[model samples]
Structure formats: structure tokens, C-alpha cells
Target: MRTLTFFNHKGGVGKTTLTVNVADALADQGLRVLMIDADPQCNLTAFYLDEKKLDALLGESDDADGGTLWSAIKPVVDGKGGIKPVDAYKIKNGLYLCPGDVLLADYEEELPAAWTGSFARKGRDYDVMCALSAAAREMGQRYEVDLVIYDIGPNVGPLNRAILLDSDFFCTPVAADLFSLRALSTVGRAVARWITDWKTVRGLASAESRDKLLHGLPTYLGYVTSAYKVSSGRISTRPHDYWESKIAPRVKNRVVDVLRAVDPTTVPFPSNKLAAIKDFHSLAPQAQEYGLAIGKLRTHVNSGYNAQILEAATEFSGLATIIRKRMGI
Candidate 1:
């Protein structure tokens, strides 16, 4: 099983959209998929289930009973290891989601006491990375997960750090704008630093161990421009074309340069064009009314919606293929 986190330090880059819909697309192909909504916003959860039902699913027990991911994962962190099998978890059919809560924001402040002195050591407390990855691994082993997709928040805090470190790889769904470019660069540096830091702490001596640990480090999966205008089944106008063609290449080159400057082995992933979700205005209204994801909605379908979904799905499918090739899958 492989874990992929869809992330960016920039919000509103369609991170949740890519994570949810891409998982749906993969599920459509009959692959077992698990999506973890690591963001406090829980937007992906909203996309798949109604609020009342979602609350019931998550609120089945009080927080102390290990009802949420925080409680569910604490045992692993405490060294009482082993994840509940995938089938034991609350997943429906081909896909399951580990929803995140606002409480997730508190993890950093509560960094396990053990992590304090470990910074100067040869390796980090395996508990930190292990707790997260091991849970995913165990679930994958149990259910034979084909893919694990994580929808993370827009920060370099402990929660995001843990998610990035745990995932086999990650992709940034960034907007084609200056702020997004800056945020991407910032995240690139953080990722590079974290990878090196964790590796050094691991005290990796054997070439094999070094290879295994570094292998999981996040690599760029290229950029996907969200909310792009479409007309005649293509990006409209020279400005949009320039943004799509020249500007994106230029910024992406700089991002790649930054990553390489920090670590030459860091390579950017191939990217593809994703037209805006068609009639987003209409789709948003419909989603709000019906409590459904535009992609998951069965009624009120339109050509624009179909086109957008297909475009987004195809782009992510191409990304999945590239990633599979990288992992030699």
C-alpha cells in the first residue's frame, strides 16, 4: 500500500477537492482507497457524508474513549502498538476516511514529552513518525489498501509535519498565483529540512536503512492550477494561457530550483492542466442545498460539471501513474 498526502501551505488551492475527488476516481477503478481528512476544516468529510450522519459516526463515543483519530492513534504513540485492521475501521465499500477535528490543532502543544531531548540524538523517537505511518501501514496490510490519500491543512505545524513524514509521497495542489508560489516554496524548504533532520536523527548507518527512510520522503507531484476558466473545451484567453504555459513553467522551475538547491535528489513531479470545476457557482449552490459533493452528486448533472470532473479525474489519474512508476509499482 502507498500513502499520498495532498497538501500545500496555501489554503484554497483545492487541496481537499483533489484529495476527495481523486480518491473517488481511484475507487471508481476498483482500488481500495482510504482518505484521512487531516485538516481541521473537515471539508472532505462534508463532501462525502451529511453533517448529522458524520457527527454520529465521529461522535459514537466521548473523546476519552478513543472515539476520534486522536484517541484512536494515541495507543500506538504510547508504544502499545498495532492499528485496528482496516475492516475494523468505519469505511464504506471501496473507500474509508479518517476524519480530522479542530482538536487536531492542539497536537503541537502536546508534543509527546519524549520528543524534547531527542533532537540532538542520532535519530528521532521512532514513536513520532512510527505512530502515524504504522497505523496507515497496519490498515493497509489488513485491507490491502491500494492507496491512502491524506487531505492536510495549510501549515508546517506538527500535524502537517507528521502527515508529510508518514506518507510515502505527497503532492501540492497549488493555485497559479504569487501567494501560492511563495507558500509552495516555503513548504518545499520545510519538507527538505524535515527529511534531512529526520534522516540524521534516525542515525541511519546501513545503506539499506538510509534508503528505506529516505524513500518515504515527500517528492513534488507537480502543480495543478485550480479554478482555471474554460471555453471551447480549453483554457481561454492569452493571460490564462500565459499563466498555464509560461508562468507556471517559470514558477515551477523556481520551485524545483529551490528544492534541488536544498537537496539535489529532490525532483518535481509531472503536472497536468485541470480546468476549473465547471459552473462552480452552480455546483456550490447545489452542494450546499443537498449536502453532497459536486463530484458525488447524481442529480442536476450538467455538461459543465461532467467536463470539470473528467478533467480533474484525468489529471489525477496521470499523477497516480507517474507516482506508481516512481515507486516501481
Candidate 2:
């Protein structure tokens, strides 16, 4: 199975929206999909299941027994050797969730232990870094899944470092604004550094040992721009001018160019026109309320929303198709 992480160092770029809804789109195509909420905030979980269900699913438990993602890697934090898979909810026939929790913050402090010389030389850092991916892999195989998508928090912390390295590839969600444009640069350079740094550490590991656990970092899988207004099914005039004149070029320079500079083998990202996406009016809230996808809201909600829902569905279906083709999945 292939793994993809929907991420951006900048928040509020509709990262979770794309991550969750894209999973829906793929599932609708009969692909077995698994979504892991790696963000401590647990926004994806809240979006799909709501607070009432979260309380029921991941009720109070000790660190050792928390049904959230923390359970899977708690052994690593306790200095154990490897990770085990955790329980996930089957949201539908083809989609599942390894839910998230606010208590996940409790484990973030555990990641810093990797900084020690002992952890690096022993390859324990790699194991801890790969805990989520390892679990996802095992779960994917068990369920015969086609894709695993991760919804990650916006940060440069060690937790994110691990998640990035584990995924097969990542696509960023940007808002077509200055902050997100700058974040595109930040994510690009930081990813390059982490990839090289982990490579060096892996090289130092004992040859022929089973404990050298570091896997190579994921490659860039282009990006998506969300919440932009569209006219005639194209980016609206005002936002298009600002984006075309400033943001798009900077992303080409910072994100695409930066990755290529670090590793010329890095795949060139798609154009801004392909990446820019529109927000469908009245879709998000309806999806959250009904546990539905933006693409499915037309059937679940009133017929009056038919046109708007079709626009959202077509957008994600096209986006998912491009992603699958580009990533060779």
C-alpha cells in the first residue's frame, strides 16, 4: 500500500478538509483507504466523528491503554524495541480511522529523547520515528488497503519529522496567501535537511544489523491551494492576479526549486493552476454534521445544494486523479 501525508506548516489552509475529503473521494472509487490523524489537535477526528463519539471511542485510559495513536507508540516511549498496531474505527466499507486525541500532546515530549547520542547510535530514534508508519503498514496489509493518508499538525517539531519520513510522499495545502507561500519555502528546505540528516545517521548504523530502522524520507508530491474563489470554474480575478504575480512564482522558487536544488531527482511539482482549488459554499459544515464527504453531501442533504455539491465533488475527484497519476500509485 502507498502512504500519503496531507500537510502544511501553515495552518488554516484547509489541510484537514482536503485530507479527509480526498480520502472520501478515493473510498468512493472503491479504494480501501485508511486515515491517521497525527495532529495533536485531532481536528480530523472531530470532523468525522464529533465530540460525543470521540468520548465514546477513546475514553479515559492510562498511557499504556489509551485507544488513541498514543497507544501504538507508548511502548517505544517506555524504551521497548518495536511498535504494535492500535485499534481503528471502520468508518465505512472502505475507509478506516486511527483516531487522534488531544492527549497526544503527552507523547510529544518523548520524541526529544532521540537527541541523545545513545538513541541515534542505537537506531532507537528511527524506530520511534517510524512507529506510526509501521503501525499503518501493518494495518494496511491486514485490511488490504490501497492508500494510507495522514493528517498532520502544522509544525517543525520532532513528531512531524518522524511522520514526514515515514510517508511515501506528501502534498501541501496552501491558502494562496503570503504566509502560506512562505510556509511552502519553509517546508521545502526543512524536508531536504531532515532527509539528508537521517541518511547520514542511517549510514553510521551497524552494517547488517536489524536495528538500523531509518527509512528514507518521502518525496514531494506537488501541492494544493484551497479556499480560493472561482469564476467560470477558474480562479477568480483578484486572487488569481495576486497568486499568479507573486505566490505562484515564489512556490515554484521556494518549494519546487528548493527540493530540486537539494536533490535534483526530486519530482517537479505541478503548476499553480493545477494545484489551486475552490471552496464549495455550505459543504464543510454539512459534511461535519452528517459524517459525509463534500462529494456525498448532495445525496445526504437537500436537492437545493446539488450544483454546489457537484462542484466540490468534481474538484476533489479531479484532484485525486491527478495525485494518483503523478505519484504513480
Candidate 3:
């Protein structure tokens, strides 16, 4: 299965919302999709599960067991064993969710030491570094999924570094604002360095460990511009257009160009803008409340929301198609 991650260091960019809905849309198109909530915030998990179910999975209830992403990798983090098998929650016919845990933040503490020991080709350190990827692959194979999408927290932390390295492709979800524009350079520079560093470490690893290592080269799929207001069928406000106009040039200069300079072979896409997602407004909260995708929200609401529901369905469907085409799926 192909792995894709939706990431942006800037918060409040609707990254989790976009990831969940897009996975739902892909599932609707008959693809078996598995979503990994790698974010410690657990927002993606909360989106699909109610509080009681979430409490159980997160180990806050009497029925708690090994069902979360953290549960799978905890053994490796503690230097006890390889990753344990995790039973992903089936959200619908074709969509599944590997629940996230607030305890995931604790894994970050071990990463710094593992990263250092990796230079010496320490076997345990390699195991720790590759734990998440190995677990994800095992789960993907077990489920026979067509696509695996990861929803990571907003940061350039060690945990996120490992996730980005393991991913086959990544897309940035950004808002039409100054903060999102400024974040492009930070993400670009950090990823380039990580790729370079990973290459060095791979050469230092033993043959066996080298075979298990991914290339650490996640191709840029492009950016999704979200949370902008829409008129009849287009952007309504002048302020929104002004910021939107700035996105392409900034992304090209700050992100695409920087990445190309590091490894031209990895930069094959011609464009940086993937899709312009119109603001979902009321539909977002309604969908979240019911733990449903915007397209599926129609069944939970009255006739007055038919038009907005249709618009949401069309928007996410188009985004899913673009993503599939870009990935050559």
C-alpha cells in the first residue's frame, strides 16, 4: 500500500479535518483506506469515535487494551521487543482508523537518544527509529489496504521526522494567511536536512538494517489551500484573493525550489498548488458532531442543508481525484 501524510507545521490550518474527509472520500470511491492518527492530540481519532469508545482505546477505561498506535510501538520504545500488532477500528465499509493516543508524546523522549545511537549502527536504536514504519507496514499488509494516510501533529519534532521519512508522499494543508506562507520555508529546509542526514545514516548501517530502511525521500504532492470563503462558486473576498495569489510564488520559492536544490530527482511535480478547498463553515462542525464525512452528513441533517452538502461532496470528491492522479493510483 502507498503511504501518504498530510502535514503542516502551522496549526489551525484544518489539516486533520482535510485528512479525515479525504480518506472518507477515497473509501467512497471503493479503495480500502487505513488512516493512522499519529498526532498525539488525537483529533482524528475523536472525529470518528465517541467519548466512551475513545476512553477505552486510550487506556482510560476498564476495557482498555492494545488498540492504539502507541500500544503497537510502546514495546520498541521501551526496548522490550518489536512492534506489537494493533487492531485498527473499522469506521465504515472501506475505511479504517488506527487510533491515536495522548501517550504518544512520551515516545518523543526516546527519539533523541535513538537518533544519536543510530550513527553507531546500534541495532536497538534502528529498531526504535523504524518502529512506526514497520508497524504501519505490518498493519497495512494484514488489512490488505489500498492506501494508508497519516494525520500527524503540527511540528518538526523527532516523531514527525520519522513519520515524514517513512512516508512515500506528503501534502501540506495551508490557510491563506501570512503564518502559513512563512511556515513553508521552515518545513522545506527541515525536510531537506532530514533527507540528507538519513542518507548518511543509511550508509553507516549494517546490510541487514539497511535493507529495512526506507529511502527517507517523501515526494512533495503539493499544497491544499483551505478555509477560504467562497461566493457563488469562487472566492468571495478581496483579502482572500490577495493572500491566495501569494501562495504559489511563496511555495515555489520557499518550498519547491529549496527541495529541488537538495535533490532534483525527488522534485518531479510541476505545480505546487493541489486544490483550493472552499471553507466548509457550518458543515465542518456538523460533520464533526456526528462523526461523519461532509458528504455523508446529508443523512443526518434536514433538506435545508442539501445544497451545502452537495457542495461539500463535490469539493472533497475533486480533491480525492487530484490526489489519486498525483499518486498514479
TM-score of each: 0.77, 0.89, 0.94
Q: Report the C-alpha lDDT of model 1 over 264-327, residue by residue, as the tens digit.
A: 5556444432233323546555654554345555445666577654554565566555545554
Error of 3 at 291 (Å): 0.9
- lDDT of candidate 2 over 1-329, digit per residue (tens): 88898778888788788887788888887788999888988888888787777886667534555677767766766677566566778989899988886756766776667634423575566556556667777777878888989888998787787778777788878785667777877888888877777777667777753354546568677777765454356655575556656766776777778777677656555453345677666778888888878878877888988988888888898888877776676
lDDT values, one for every candidate: 0.60, 0.74, 0.86
Best model per TM-score = 3
Q: List all candidate RMSDs to the true structure.
A: 5.0, 3.6, 3.2
What clash count goes with each model?
A: 3, 0, 0
Residue 261 in candidate 2, Cα distance off native in Å: 2.0
By summed lDDT, the worst window of 10 consecutive residues in model 1 runs over 270-279
Lowest lDDT 10-residue stretch of candidate 3:
56-65
Best by lDDT: 3
